[model samples]
Target chain A: MTGERTVGERTIGEQVVGEQVAGGGSGTDDFYGRLRAYEGRAAVAGGEGRDAVNEPMIRHWCEAMGDTNPAYPASAPPTMLQVWTMGGLSGHTGGSIRSEAYDELLALLDGAGCTSVVATDCEQEYLRPLRPGDRVTFDAVIESVSPRKTTKLGSGHFVTTRMDIRAGGELVGKHRFRILKYAPARRSSAAKERTTEVKEARRPRPVINRDNAGFWAGVAEHRLLIQRCTDCGTLRFPWLPGCGACGCLEWETVEASGAGTVFSYVVMHHPPFPAFDPPYAVGLIELAEGVRMISNITGVPYDKVRIGMPVELEFLRVDADLELPVFRGAVA
Target chain B: MTVRVGDELPPLRIPITRTLIVSGAIASRDYQDVHHDAEAAKEKGSPDIFMNILTTNGLVGRYITDHFGPHVRLQKVAIRLGAPNYPGDEMVLTGQVTAVTDGTAEVSVTGRNGIGNHVMGKVTLRLSLDFPHGEADSPQRGAR
Candidate 1:
């Protein structure tokens, strides 16, 4: 477990310290080789949880979550698998194993100016129930380091790690955590505006896949469309590849009659985005044809949106190039 | 509480606000920017910031366990995502007991967001053969 080791197509070192491994591509790839060296290596060991699974903490968590599951005091939420291992406000100072290779990889990134970090995504699998008095322990490994990727948050590498949570040496769950450590993306003044005009105009392009391509095409022509299973004659909204009723893969489109009612809706107020205005009514409209579709509700104030409110199909020209299907609130 | 097949669990209506999404993500130790930042989410081809699957999963777990009370042990939660739960929306969760055995039950749940069904799945839960919620926690009643 000393100097250089060869794994697959690349050569890595167990104790390479901070040696910058020259990469095969551009500046983005400059330090990838060095970062990738930490993969498959142990990053933390002998990590003891802050406290054993208990009722008080579970109650606190449940209260914060507004979860009234009467099962928590008797049994912990499977989703709280990682809470036991958290370092908390005390930080990762005690009862946890820290790996030199992992620290060095982070340091290398810090030195290269990709300092800001953000958690991207994680997947977890529960294997056993955690009850009160279960003393949790875990060990983590540097799972993988993705090559450089440029995102809206800037350019960086995605570092993923896997942790095994054990209770009394028996595996209870597994958590795969991924994070992006990178330099923040630069935004133009136009995008930094706080006015009503700019933020409402920068709508992100719709993601169109083969299954739903015709739906967007229909929108461009001022036609509200629904997918009808040719085999079963069943109607569906927001098109899908196959019919749920018959599993038929063939389908055809029928123009909507431009009628519907508000089945449900929500008004956004915080964590503002660059496109949609806050307190705007985004509704799930149950069309006259029986299939439901979601779109912005207009022709009424935000608070006026209500269930069973009449609405009609209309096209909204968000920007010079983007026209989306919207529903106009009709007279009561 | 004893549950029988066809027992309907009261639907839980959760407001799809940015705070709700962000708090849930952070509580779960998830730091993915897409869960919290909208502009960055747009860069990733999403309409706006959308709820992560984990949050939806956690909600599903809570939705079932909440109904079964605290004694039910979740054996498995298999779910598939359908639509995104964007902010400015509401998620209505509904569940029904699908099966019941000697000491366990199977419940099917569907959480519908504005876009469509945000998550749809089943939860296999285990508990004592017979018990009541108030009595189940009597052992730990005064530990507070």
Candidate 2:
């Protein structure tokens, strides 16, 4: 299955180069020379993402990550920089635009017994936020390839690729990904034991700035304060500086009535952080004052925290230094 | 509020689960066998399916906005990975304000897992200056 998929993804130009390189037995100098030749060459040109920036994928990503920020529904998370350039399971179709140099580079590494590959890291700069319905196009280049180096993973070469993602012909973001293709090293028992050591982690502290300092102070006082626009009477939950309705900079704090319903919610089941238990429910609670805030929904099983369920505001003491506003839901 | 160079952003802890690995991979349109198919990953010399770079990027972006609020605009996020994020592991992401000028702030961020530092990088973001500053409930016009 892997062999078939690999061949199917390669371009005709690459297959020809693969055959040429396969017959030649080269020394280390020749191998390094050949590898260096591919640097600065285009790896992919005019590649298109299988799908445009859309809501479903964004929603799926947010659900998996337990992120409920309101800004995401309209604009995509900036870190999804490479999703638009992926070829997926079937690989790039409709005549691969992948450069022959890239194929030969990987084939050379595979022939040298550096068959295993792992993504080391990536860097992204967002020029603009991607919105739904934007068709993404990208071009990638072999940014660099490092000389052989020995590490815990064994001896291998590092390959870095840079991609520029565009929407409507306008550059939107740049992504640089580095991967190590290496031969697996034998694991020592002592090294294996170190992986099992667990460290205690605290719940992430909420970002407190001038705009939201008042909200945290309210939480400290066990009061749920909603920001009310003094001029327009519009209420906002996140405590923004200005009113979205009247553009009013004047606002006052109105203590929430404490009655609310679950507007939307997600059950977190994976990537358990140290401070949180698995399968817990995080909800978007709609206060009776008609504004929504994201918080943990307690007092019920994660599965039973349904939308529209009544919930009351309460402060949760996550640690000695932190007290968060969470909601209590009744079991149906 | 005025952002100082030494301001520290809150830390966030993320769980590493098989479901998150698979979901994140698919969500990012990365169908690499090593990212979702454990058997395929074993064939490639990995212990199990691992998180993809796109997912890490998404998480980092979320961590930034979660603190700076929804109005914060991300300008750049350049990160380097040191350790792999595998299932049954936890990653704690921490950040500090390194520089601030003309409504733009540069932050240094680090995400550490059990094995070691998983990611390290810098993020440049532009903060909206229109928000009312000082005395949370009082109106201040054109206050810097």
**TM-scores of all predicted structures:** 0.47, 0.61
Count clashing residue pairs in model 2: 6
Report the CAPRI category for model 1.
incorrect
Model 2 DockQ class: acceptable
Give the candidate number with the greatest lDDT.
2
The residue-by-residue lDDT of candidate 2 on A22-104, one tens digit each, is: 22445765777788889999999889878889998889888877778898858888877677777776777786668888888
Cα deviation at A6, candidate 2, in Å, is: 36
Error of 2 at B40 (Å): 3.4
Q: Which pairs clash in the backbone of model 1?
A: A69-B66, A70-B69, A70-B70, A71-B69, A71-B70, A72-B70, A119-B31, A119-B32, A120-B32
Per residue, candidate 2 scores C-alpha lDDT tens digits across B1-144 of 556667788899999999988898888888888888887775445677888877887788888889888888989877666677899999999998766666777778888889777777778888887733223322222242
| Model 2 alpha-carbon drift over 4 Å, by segment | A1-26, A95-97, A188-332, B131-144
Winner by DockQ: 2
